[model samples]
Target: MKSVTRSLRILEAVAQHQPVTVGELTKMFGLPKSTVQRTLVTLNEAGWLRANRKDTTRWEIGARVLAVRPAALQGSSLFAAAREPMIRLRDTLNETIHLSVPDALQSMVVVDRVDCTHAVRTFHAIGDTSPLHATATGRAILAHLPKADIDELVEHGLERFGDSTPTDDGQLRADLARVRADGYSVNRKQYRPDVCAVAAPILDEDGTPLATVAASMPESRYDEQRVPELGRLIADAAKEIAARRNGA
Candidate 1:
């Protein structure tokens, strides 16, 4: 409770008075300088805060925040960033591929998408939220989330989208643990009754899960024999995205 309060306070402070200094935050929040300094320093190191070039003494949100903007997806800005990778992955897998992110408290949506070559293939909603406990994209993002976020999400329980969607914590935890351990995630008909997908989290330099890249296929393409291969392929795609993102 105490830690949550402190982090929230820090985030609120930053959000409210974005370009603020450590001294100013300490004074406004009535927190000890030591405490305020430590929090701001950590945020800065995590790329959540940056020193203003106009005045090195002040800090504000950094480029990492800018990169996630849906508004930036217009024309050259959004497509230039994600189109090539989305195209290449779709081509290689011969399946629908998506670059998706959280849309609401419970759903994930595709901001960018590529259709598969097959006449009959899984389809995804470009601006829709896949289920929290069903899609590989959600699991991949959840795997890297802070413990509080995961626990809070599970307390809400899984929203059933299919017969296989897990509504229990034990199984979700096990699945998420495997995702973290293997650097990727896999889902088998957990969302749509006949759709399966694999996903991996794209990380920034600080190792924060920025977003997810995933491939959707029909249930017919799934089997233990092919699951591992799919996991590897999705992970490779995520790594490629991460490399390009970091470079940009």
Candidate 2:
């Protein structure tokens, strides 16, 4: 534990003076050169620091630490709560299953997912972010938010990420209004080309939106006659998650 704390101290010093040298680290931490070098080696091995071979003998943060974040986050941590339902839904539809929470922006944030059986399955790996105006998941949560919150997100401006992305404010408002009347949102290749999604709001007992759930599939395989069945699957799965969340 002492060694761990000491290594963290060295890391802190390195961060404070990033791209610093071993000598500089030794001086900053007032530790022996051997201790600094050993700590640097350990941190580098663990992907916490990078050793630059060029001038200044520079050591910087490694891609390991930055690219792959530790699974330490503060929140309701509800992903675990939905695992069973996600699996059930994945088997039920043989399509990709996704769950996300609302971000500060109008965008939907992917937090968890279950891949489909096919190699050609939709791949929305966890943590992928989706646009508010172009994704079923985003519209699901947005439809349930109050007018003021929706207005705040709209004021931030819509950013286009795909060919069919909706940046027009008036059209987006109309679409959201339709979502309110229909009780679900359907995004047809509006986010990714040739990709489509159906999403439903997961509500708490008080009828407030807590999160959104989506079932995504390829547009080529879409059956207009079967869309209602797909919507039923998504809506039912979302309700199961909501009940567990609200203890209803």
Candidate 3:
């Protein structure tokens, strides 16, 4: 009973401070490092937590954790606010539209999506996760985060998903600057070889990104000449979702 209680507490702590190291959890719980490590390993085996890909010493919430709470997300304020906007965006662009929220600073989790009619459109499951530096929805959220947080994420080392992923620190920073200035982000075969997306952050009243709204399609259908138009449309959709979220 005591071990179960300790494991639950450790899981809660990891959820709150994900991509956290076992040493950090040990210090937080005032438990021996070995005890914390064992609990973490147990949780990892059970699919409640997963080690960060870049730094195996750190742990983050896993797919199973997300899978169990999907109903909660479906009933949440963000989902309610984003649903209409996502559908409208998909209809307008004839491309799959996704609503994603940041999973700590590690990745973006797709919470909902509206599919386009095209047979070859891009697709993402509700619990699908994407690297923050390699996807339009992820970069849109990152661009609105505090500088310190961005610096920490960069220091953690950006994993390369493909040739177009922004792994260079300086280059990523520059790209984020453009995202901020333009109020949107773009991805062209960055995270997925055949996916292209344009997205914008949905900011809360405090101007922090609560989620991102993206229009995604197959790379074969991506039109570079339409980037500015797509950026504007997606940015407007994000603003509408934000407004709806705030009860405006």
RMSD of each: 12.1, 6.8, 4.7
Q: Give one digit per residue, the lDDT tens place, for model 3 in 95-189.
A: 99998888889689888889999988787998888889988998898898999999999999999989989998998999999999999999999
Off by over 4 Å in 2: 1-77
TM-score of 2: 0.69
Stretches off by above 4 angstroms in model 3 are: 1-3, 9-62
The candidates, ranked best first by TM-score, are 3, 2, 1
Per-residue CA lDDT of candidate 1, range 80-161, in tens?
Answer: 5566877887888788988877643466766777898887788765556566678899989888878888888888877787
> Each model's TM-score, in the order given?
0.67, 0.69, 0.80
Between prediction 2 and prediction 3, the one with superior lDDT is: 3
Q: Which candidate has the top score in lDDT?
A: 3
At residue 198, candidate 3 shows an lDDT of 95
Model 2 per-residue lDDT tens digits across residues 1-248: 38999988887777668889899888877888998899999999898898765753789866554333213321354565577898999998888988877665535667778898877767875556677767998888877778887677778787786776777778777888987777778888887888888888888877888778888888877777787788888888888887776665
Better of 1 and 2 by TM-score: 2
TM-score top scorer: 3
Per-residue lDDT value at 95 in model 3: 93
